[model samples]
Target: MDYNLMREFADSWGLLAMALFFVGCVAFALRPGGRRQADEAARIPLKDD
Candidate 1:
């Protein structure tokens, strides 16, 4: 395995992929109806199993 080549690829493509994934997650979290889902999840720990 070539460490320098891998580092270059990660510095380019890996960073782009991470940025896209982060944006997608933020968009999903902010979408309509997300608050309702999040509220429901917030109650799970207090609910009877």
Candidate 2:
């Protein structure tokens, strides 16, 4: 197995970029405003009538 090549690829930029994106997503999801927005959106699809 070429472990070195795999490590190099991850260390280049893709892994860091993905990590930053994931963190941003998590932060946004955890925010109070995000939670409220999600709750409201969820209810919009439900059958109320």
Candidate 3:
């Protein structure tokens, strides 16, 4: 493929793909009951075992 074609595809589709992925991650993080899991993970370093 030519450089111009590849660059055009990446400039549009690549940006859309990255934006969707970021939104999905934010949704997952903010979902119900996520807070408890996040808190437990935060305390992992303090655990002895």
Mind giving the per-residue lDDT tens digits that candidate 2 earns over 1-49? 5999888988987788999999999998998788789988899979587
- Lowest summed lDDT over 10 consecutive residues: which window, candidate 3? 6-15
Q: Over the stretch 1-49, how does candidate 1's per-residue lDDT look in tens digits? A: 7999999999999999999999999999999999999999999999997
lDDT by residue (tens digit), candidate 3, 1-49: 9999999999999999999999999999999999999999999999999
Report, for all candidates in order, the number of backbone clashes.
0, 0, 0
Error in Å for residue 7 of model 2: 8.8
**Could you estimate the TM-score for every candidate?**
0.88, 0.64, 0.92
Clashing pairs in 2: none
CA deviation > 4 Å runs, candidate 2: 1-10, 47-49
